[model samples]
Target: MIITNITSQKDPERVNIFIDNEFAFGLFYSTKEELGLKKGLEIDEETIDKIKVRDELQSAKSKAYHYLSFRQRTQKELEDYLFKKEFSEDTIENVIQSLSQAGYIEDLDFARIYVRDKTTFKKFGPYRIKNELLQKGVSKELIDLALEEEYHEEIQELVDLVKTKYSSIIQDKSEKRFRRIGGYLQRKGHSFETIRKVLDSIDGKDD
Candidate 1:
């Protein structure tokens, strides 16, 4: 087929490629330039298929990079994002492999950083952080390793959190007050045992 036209899309970086007076496909302007595609240039069907594959892979990588620019993402998250964007499995796998090799898609690093941020900034407990990582598609082994390496539950910090945030309930010194305090901590990702320890410390029951 002979190339008939190359019209720029609304996106300046992209262009619509027409072959034999029929709209063939859209491709990156760079790809068009690199391949020396122009009006009346003769191309074959096999060449068109190859160009489409290359263009799709490039497009998938671009989308993945943009999505990751906002924050670190797990492989599964990127896979889901690319799937939603209608990229083929082969393209998705290629993009993922490329990103992984380039050190842009490290689930273990993402998990470690996530754990540190949640524990330090959000004061989230291990359980809640674990659930959040799981939801983000991090592996169980990586999550456990990250939690072990990064999660240092400062008893004093928990004490301060309870004393400052739940002082009213603490002052009540009733079973109901204990239950409420425990519930709040539990929701914050603390285990029942840790909550009990904190309550005991608060109630002068800690030895």
Candidate 2:
């Protein structure tokens, strides 16, 4: 096809390119320059294919940056978002590598920040935080390391949280109460063993 025209977009950073007098695509000015695209230039099918790939990569990366502008996201979250937006695998992978190398996407850093927020602010327990990070595409090793470094602090926080729940007014150690407290801890992502241990100290009741 023959290039018919190239026009500046309102954003100034992008341009609309028409081939054979028909609008084909919009590309960043940088892409336009790199591709040496200009009016009246002749492009074969193979060259058009290359341009499509470049456009896809640029579009996908731009979307990724826009998504991350709000806050950080996990690799899996980014991938899923791009996939839903209909970006191809090659484009998604390219964006991922670019963002990761740029330090915009770091699993370990994300895990640490996420864990701290959930624990300190939201009061989420180990099980819940670990599960969340896993779902967010953090490796098990990194999760273990992040939690292990603050093992004592986390356990102490868990104990304090349980105390806050079990005030002195509720003295009855009934099966129902045990179940209720256990369920609460479990829902918080605390293990049964830890729940039982805490219950033993606080309620001194049989379950």
Number of the top TM-score candidate: 1
Residue 129 of model 1 has an lDDT of 96
**Per-residue lDDT of model 1, residues 36-127, tens digit only:** 88999999999999899989998999899999999999999999999999999999999999999999999999999999999998889999
Weakest lDDT window of 10 consecutive positions for candidate 1: 166-175
> Residue 203: error of model 2 in Å?
5.3
Residue 58 error, candidate 2, Å: 0.6
Candidate 2 regions off by >4 Å?
9-12, 151-169, 200-207
Per-residue error at 112 for model 1, in Å?
Answer: 0.7
lDDT of 2 by residue, 78-102 (tens): 9999999999998999999999999
TM-scores of all candidate predictions against the true structure: 0.93, 0.84
Stretches of candidate 1 exceeding 4 Å from the true structure: 205-207
